[model samples]
Target: MIARVFGASFVVTILSLVVAFLYAGWSGVALCAILGILEISLSFDNAVINATILERMSPMWQKIFLTVGILIAVVGMRLLFPLVIVWATAGLNPVDAMDLALNPPADGAATFADGSASYETLLTDAHPQIAAFGGMFLIMLFLDFVFDDSGVTWLSPIEGPLGRLGRLPGASTVVALAALVTAAQFAADDATVSVLTAGILGLFTYLVVNGLTGLIEQDEPDDSAGPSEAVKAVGKAGLFLFLYLEVLDASFSFDGVIGAFAITSDPILIALGLGFIGAMFVRSITVYMVRAGTLSEYRYLEHGAHWAIGALAVIMLVSVDENIEVPEIVTGLIGVAFIGAATLSSIWANRRDAARQSASPVAD
Candidate 1:
């Protein structure tokens, strides 16, 4: 099962390394390897959260995710998206944006000969809006899950009250809006409008996608319905779910893309490392978890992933104040710690349950 799931990722990783080596010799290879590892560390929680959604999708849709979805992730988000951002923010034409990204200004040069901001500068300038949008979306996701009372919870003391509050209609939306407004207040004067607007848009996007998905899935097919009807229902729901997953991935990628500039300004290396290597491994991990029934066995895994997401959301919002900066490693470690703690708790619970079962008298 492991080989079946990870074989393609392994092949991709090797090819990425080879390309990196040819691009910039050993230094390129090293940088590519580091960025790949960084992406995996930062996105392990993403894999867990993805599995929760992907497991609900049909087999055909699942295949599409590995095929079409991956192209969007690697090419659309990692490569083209950054160029688009630079173009939009810096008033550069498409060709100019691509050229600037391909050949960044020398070290310590913030702008080009014509005085326009460099690709990295423009991308950094756009971070506040990016963070605000992605942060709000992720916080909404985390809040909805924590508020949900239906699932096994790892943090009962905290989640219990949140779940109770969730019974109120639109509780998550109210809280998310409140958060966006509060964060906007702390943003730089110039960035205040952008932050609020982006955050609201993020909140709106979540509502539209999640609402449509819920409305479509609320009516389960009756026993009298033919198999074709069931298939159609699954197909519709799967499409929306696939969309939700893609947006979720985009939110997760925002930080990684920004952080990659810090390590290396080369767009090609960033694509090879984060897009090709990191994303491939993450998708494989997601598939493995679903196929192995890991979520059901561990029980608390989803809870841990959500908690990590909450931490990430808070960190992103906090970092919107240009004066403050949170290291990417700190964010990655916090996620790993939460997931590790949850795994330990799950193992303990399983052992206790086994003991109780063994102690009971045999029904026979």
Candidate 2:
């Protein structure tokens, strides 16, 4: 099962490494490898969150996610998205933006023909808006999860009250908007408007996607319905869920894409590393989790992933302050720590349950 799931990712990783080596020798290979690891570390929780959604999708939709959805992730989000950002923010034509990306100055400090900052600089310059949007979206996701009264609770003291409060209408939106406003205050004066606008758009995007998904699912036939009706309902819901997963991925990738520039500004390496290798493995991991029933086996795993997402949202918001710097490693470690702790807790809980069952009286 492991080989079947990860085989494609392995092939892609090899090809990406070879391409990196051919493009810029050993240094390129090293940078590509590092960026790939960085992306995986940052996105492990993403795979968990994705699996929760993917499990509900039909088999056909699942295949599409592994195929067409991957194309969008690798090409659209990883490569073209950054270029488009640079183009739109830098006020350069698409052709020039592509050129600037493909052929960065050797010194890593050269400006554009109009004497604007370098490609990397412009991309980083757009980070405030990016962070605001992605951060708000993730904040909403985390808040909604914690606010949910269903399922097991990992942190009862905190999640319990939040869940009770979440019963109020539009609780998640109110909290997310409050967070958006708070994050905006920390933004530089020039970036404040952009931050607020992006954050609101992000919140709006989540509402639209989530609302449509809920509406579609609500129309699904009950158990007494015919197989055909059930299949149709699943298809409709799956389509919207697939879209939700993609947008969630885009939100997750925002930090990784911007952080990649810190290691190397070469667009090819970034695409090869984060897009091909890193993203492929994340998809494989998502599939593995679904097939293995990891979430079911480890009760608190989902809670851990959501908690990590909350941490990431805060990190992104806090990062809007140029004076404060949070290392990518710090972000990665916090996620890993949460997941690790959850796994341990799950194991302990399983053992305790087993012991209780053994101690219970049985019927003759």
Candidate 3:
């Protein structure tokens, strides 16, 4: 099962090597291989979050997520999304953006028409917007979990209280916005407005998506009806899940795209290196978690991942400060630690359940 689940990793390793070899020879191939690992390390928590959402979807949507969604992840985000940023920030034409990507100049030369900031420099300037948007969106997700009293707790002391407060309507959104505003106040004077706007947009995006999903999913049937219920399952492939997954995936990739620039600002390399290989691994992990029923079996996995996401969100928010540099490794390690502890806790929980069942008073 593990081998089958991780098959995509093997395939991606070979593909990344081949693509890198063709693009930049042996040295480049080695770098690509390193990048593939880096991408996975940076996004292990992403797989957990993706699994949480993927489980809500039907089989058809799951397959679509693994296939078509990955392509969009590669082409749309890693490739074109940066170009869109360049266009929006630097006021460059599409052709000019494409040219800049294909042939990125040195540090000082990545430029707008007026040559104020280079392309990469322009991208760095936009990090606050990306951070604000992705951070608020993600922090809201964490808050939603913590706010819900019914859910199992991983960090009960912290989470249990938060979950109780969640009884207040819109508590999560309010908290998230307050955090955003707090971060915005410390932002660069020139960037304060954009940061706030982007943070609000993130909050708005979450509300719209969550509200729309509820509306569409109100009529959907339960998944427990067994295989005889293919009709009901097929109907579950509504646009809401697709949109939700795409937005969720986008939030997950925000850091990777920015961090990719750290490794190599060449957009094409970023596309092939992080986009293809890293994304494929994430898809595979999502599928594996679903097939294994990881969430159901290990109750607190979702909670831990959400907490890790919250940390990531805060890290991103604080990163807007000029002096801050949250290493990619630090982000990855924080998530991995949370997930590892949760896994151990789940194992202990299973053992306790087993012992309780074994020691139950028997019918004579």
Candidate 4:
């Protein structure tokens, strides 16, 4: 089963590589690989969170996530979205932007109507937006951790009581909406607003997708005892699992999709590299967790990832202003630290459980 999954992903990866090589040759291939690894590593926490969501989905949905959803991410978001941005903002005719992106300009100066490159110009022009995005992300994270009603909060020492005070119904959603409104206002004036908007978009997307999914989920009918019934149950579970997986995948891809700009401006390379290679690895890792039922076994892993997501959200929020700067490295490392600690804690938990079982009475 693992081989089949990896094999399929490898095929896609190879196709992406071919496209990259065709566009920019060896340099493009090398750059894509390096960026792919960086994107995957930086998003390890995202993988964990995605697995948690997948565990709750139905099998059919999981398949959709792996297939159709990936196509959207790689083709629609990673490739097309950037092109759209360049076209809309930079006033490049749609065809021209597409042409420039597909066949990059020979010289940076030759790429633009203004004698500058689109990618470089967009990114540089977008520095304020990127900075804004980072700030807003951080703030969203803070609000999430601070306001969560989860039982396994690491911030309980402070949040346990204080959090209780402002815990209103739908507070997180409200804050997310507010963040979005703020971002919309400042998106034009400052890049920070755009960052804030993206974080809000992330939160809003999560809630809407998950909520709709829960409402549509069908309950399993009980049967006296039959293999057929068990099979039906498994099928339903997989469908729901796939839906949740897609939602999670979309959320996790947000940063990496945007962050791909930091690596190279070749939209083709970004989409092919991050969308296919990077995201494929993430999906593989997520599937491993689902198949292994890692979350069921390790209670704190999801918690750690959520905490990290919450932290990143908060970072995004604060980044709206110039008062602070939160590096992507710091954001990623903080997530990694949380996951590392959770892994150790999970091991400790398993050991404790085993010890207890050994000490308990057994039937003769």
For each candidate in the order shown, give its overall lDDT on alpha carbons.
0.89, 0.89, 0.81, 0.65
Name the 10 consecutive residues with the lowest summed lDDT in model 1: 220-229
Q: Candidate 2: what lDDT?
A: 0.89
98-120: candidate 4 lDDT, tens digit per residue: 77666655554535555667564
TM-score to true structure, per model? 0.95, 0.95, 0.92, 0.77
Best by lDDT: 1
Off by over 4 Å in 1: 112-115, 219-233
TM-score of 3: 0.92
| C-alpha lDDT of residue 181 in model 2 | 90
Output the lDDT of residue 331, model 4. 74
Residue range with the least summed lDDT across 10 consecutive positions in model 4: 227-236
lDDT of 3: 0.81
lDDT (Cα, 0-100) at 110 in candidate 4: 36
Best-to-worst order by lDDT is 1, 2, 3, 4
TM-score, prediction 2: 0.95
Mark the regions of model 4 whose C-alpha exceeds 4 Å error after superposition: 102-117, 123-167, 174-206, 218-251, 322-326, 360-364
Model 1 over residues 225-317: C-alpha lDDT tens digits? 565445433557778888999999999999999999998878889999999999999999999998999999998999999999999999988
Question: What is candidate 3's lDDT per residue for 109-178, written digit by digit as tens?
Answer: 6565565556677788888888899998889888887888986677889988888899998899889988
Count of clashing residue pairs in every prediction: 0, 0, 2, 45
